[model samples]
Target: MPSIRCCSSFALAAALAAPGLAAACSTCGCSLNSDWSSQGYATSLGWHLSLREDYFNQSQLRSGADSVSRSSFAYPADEEVQRKTINRNTLLGADYSFSRYWGLSLQLPYMDRHHQTIAEGDTGVSTSDARGIGDLRVLARYQGFSDDAGIGLQFGLKLPTGRFKQDFVSGPQAGELLDRGLQLGTGTTDALLGVYKFGYLTDSIGYFGQAMAQIALDAREHFRPGNSLNLNLGLRYLDAGRFTPQIQLNLHGEQRESGAQADRPNSGAVLAYLSPGIGVRITRRLDAFAFVQLPVYQHVNGLQLEPRRLWSLGLQYRL
Candidate 1:
């Protein structure tokens, strides 16, 4: 028989392993195919504030049915399922130029997420909202090589701070939602390594790209934070002397695996979108911009998350 402390540890590990099971066990995991930061270097203060609105129409699942399989307390019959989510985020930080060989960067972000599900013919709907500061990241960039044409190198980091608890809806999956949203930290540390490069195609045109992979340490049991990979590609139109107006597109994806021997699921998720954005130079020390993200494709564990589409408007200032 296991000791009391050992039993408690086992129980805790099982509980922690549940969330990833949903992603890992089914086709839904296919959606977790890439990392989240595939946008290259196109944000504002070098700071950026983005407000996004997302709408999703989920597939209907069967509820309680009547005798003879007639019509009873079924879910909304309408095929149109709707959910609205709002996210407001601010990234404040800067990149330092430490000669042509080394550099450093720091960033902190504040996030607020609100979700609502609306069903046809139903007067009462369900809602969940959370607001708080999210994780903080510190990074160092090395300028391994550069010419008048472009610069390239590797980067790495530390992520601290976790989100806080917030209200959740009541339902069968309420616990899952609450756990995903309010569990604060993953109770683990993450390390990432990435390569970035930027250069000009011409005096008036520029391009950038980056790739990164991360591994988790001290992860919760059954919830092995799988290795993640991200890629970014973008093009910009530079002003001869002033700030430039940039119209660019970004792509991102991620994958997560369950811990070994854990009865949990393992899976992947991928999100790919195109964003048209614009940036303006306000002064020698300031710039601002806005963009919209439209999901061209998204697959979660082999199932579709409805129509994966979102709109984002943002602004940034640099000093």
Candidate 2:
């Protein structure tokens, strides 16, 4: 058996490192691995590494003109404008376990953003592309309670380490509109709380679930800081003492508080997604998995940005 002191020490380390791993969640977003494992415990010192990529295409804007005619003069009364944008995200990270109940993880990410506008005469303006590293995150998980009862608690923190500049822009003209719209970091701290549970349905099949929430501490002008909640359910099949196939579904929502900035309005947003994932075990000491995130509903600040279609792929190695 591992010494109690050793386990406690590892737990402390994981808790302290939680902030770094939490930052990674900003780009990758929260995942289903609330405690870093479905079992809530590690058999030995272990490491997990993963990579992910994401792409986004925004909707096009439309405009029309209004005209008024009088006996003396005729003039256009109104004009319209629209914009389009694209974004990409790349994430990389790794984690280490000191014992079955304790572990630490960290992640870093890079982001690219592009914007453009088209006018009525087939004329267009292309904004420069902006690329740079995003925020960083650290995470820690401890199986506070485990065994026949099948329950545990995991805590996490997020730190702001990414670059933040008010004047930085993709085009020659820089302003708050662009800075706030294309923010790379929230410039604030965030905290997470989660609960985990698992059970067996049969000798070869098992089930796991988790509930998580996050709170952000800083608020940007016209942007209200907010909280998010996530719930996950998974089914796992064990075989040959080597490979396990797993499938999972997740539901999530977020609420934002109103802000004071007059130029920007504060509004709430909600999102729901259904994802299917699979895990493969290469050996007793190594495992990998991949999944796609597809949105079912999304409302941003009372505006609908796009149709519910997005996907993410990731691979993990355990050592």
Candidate 3:
């Protein structure tokens, strides 16, 4: 029993699926499309709930696509020299939908993070602050081919529960640790795959697309983490009054990191973003959303640290 125009564009496209600072590179963390938009549209059924938030700040310093300066990262630059990272992300979702195809979903994340770095010749400037929970996803979907289901397919897992050997509580690497791509969890276990589609080109417009992947599976202590992909494409505007407007383009990529506590050349990247949003219904079951993700292309693979804009907000319910 899903209506209100199919969960209002998946609760405003999950506000671009924030997902916290999923590791600073290696394709980076979440770019949206968590379990098919996280809150709705698995093609009608039952149960639903969602909550999301995502913020970003990564202080410039690029490489593959230019922008790199910060006193050459340090002295005689042998690398190492990151300065700033502040991300806040919280996501919580739950869904059922055992009909119209199939469905099951769960996502929970939390991360506060803060960091600063400088080393390779040392010049002070080393810090860290960690927060709780991260990593934990579970998904499943299928959209009976036709029957107005609009196509779908997804699968998931990504559990490692969160918290992985964190360290560096303050200053000059106080207590060391930190950096397995910026901990908070990456302790292995990962696998997810995806596909999605939506329709309608008129009648008030509608569109959607998705792709996902994560990989990993095992490798901890000696580090592994790397392997990612995310893609989203959206458009929505259906009016029946109650506001609704959307836009999206998102994209992501990754592949790097390996044994020996990797950092394999600053991980990996190939980002892109452009989200824009609005959504509200607040009735017939509730809904609300917001987004703004700007990046429009980045390249990374060396220096790292990026983030010029990113913001998200969300809420959804139907139970």
Candidate 4:
């Protein structure tokens, strides 16, 4: 028979794990994928704030890792130049739950980017750097499902708050404009819809699944980004002392960008990642989490730079 303290600890673990923990995704583009972050944690009326950072460095032009079979254009053997990019992001997000049934979340991010394009014949590299605030996202959530399980719907808007037309200031392309896709923001308003579900597989383990769709409501500067969808499925262990271990499978797909300024050939892809993470409960109202997403499968429409791996780290506090 289990002791009373052990039983109580189990109950506490279950109670804490029943609600979704809050954490941001690393690959939602400029939009906020906050649906999974609010689950299992916002069961009551409370305010939550989180600070997260993620990094990605893309130096290789891959058509799925060294194979250019799917690319529409092939590089000549003499062509020695391609593109490389390094992106860093810092995000601050806040959430307020009016009750167990209603909540709102807002996120703002600062983006730092460095892009380099090598010349075809020369070994010279041209570099352009841009740093500024990115887009903003606001989401309203409604959780009208049974208390024992979690199911919810989210509707939101993405505001264009960053710079879309960034010019190369000190490179070979100086005075020339960068690709619209490489800009800090889309300069278009977007609509977001999402669904999430959370439940227990057993007494000591839990699972969550979420899907989100983002579409541009309007175009800007004759450029319109493509529609995107993100799906995540994860499992977590509840009774692991102060450390919760989790694994997630994430699938992200996008339609190609369209417009006169769009680079359709290098715009869209469907990628699958295996993300493993750990959650630490620092206190009753504070928590920390980190995740690393590794690409298991990738299919790009054209030649593009894709990161070998991505990582996210964050801290959350409830008030």
lDDT of 1 by residue, 1-319 (tens): 1112111110000000011222211111111111111222321113322222222222222111111121333565342122344444444444554544455555554555455543334434456666655555555555445443134444554364754344456432343333232233333456766766555577566555666555565555334444555555656565434434444344444454555422232244454556555555555434445545555654444311222333333333333
Q: Using TM-score, give the best candidate's number.
A: 4
Local accuracy of candidate 3 as per-residue lDDT tens digits, 1-319: 2345755544444222222222343333447543444323645668788788887788887888888778644363566778778778788888888887888788888888787877566777778888988888887887777677776777878888888788887676789788777887787888888777777677777777777777887888888777776778788788657777878788877777788877787777778888888777778777777878888789877778888887888877777
lDDT of 3: 0.71
Query: How well is each residue in 152-180 modelled by candidate 4, as lDDT tens digits?
Result: 77788888997878887765567667677
Cα displacement (Å) at residue 139, model 3: 2.7
Model 3 scores a TM of: 0.35
How well is each residue in 167-202 modelled by candidate 2, as lDDT tens digits?
A: 424332434243333446555577767777766677
The stretch of ten residues in a row with the least summed lDDT in candidate 2 is 9-18
Task: Output the TM-score of candidate 4.
Answer: 0.84
Models sorted by lDDT, best on top = 3, 4, 2, 1
User: In terms of TM-score, which candidate is stronger, 1 or 2?
Assistant: 2
Give TM per candidate.
0.64, 0.69, 0.35, 0.84
Candidate No. with top lDDT: 3
Give candidate 2's whole-model lDDT. Answer: 0.48
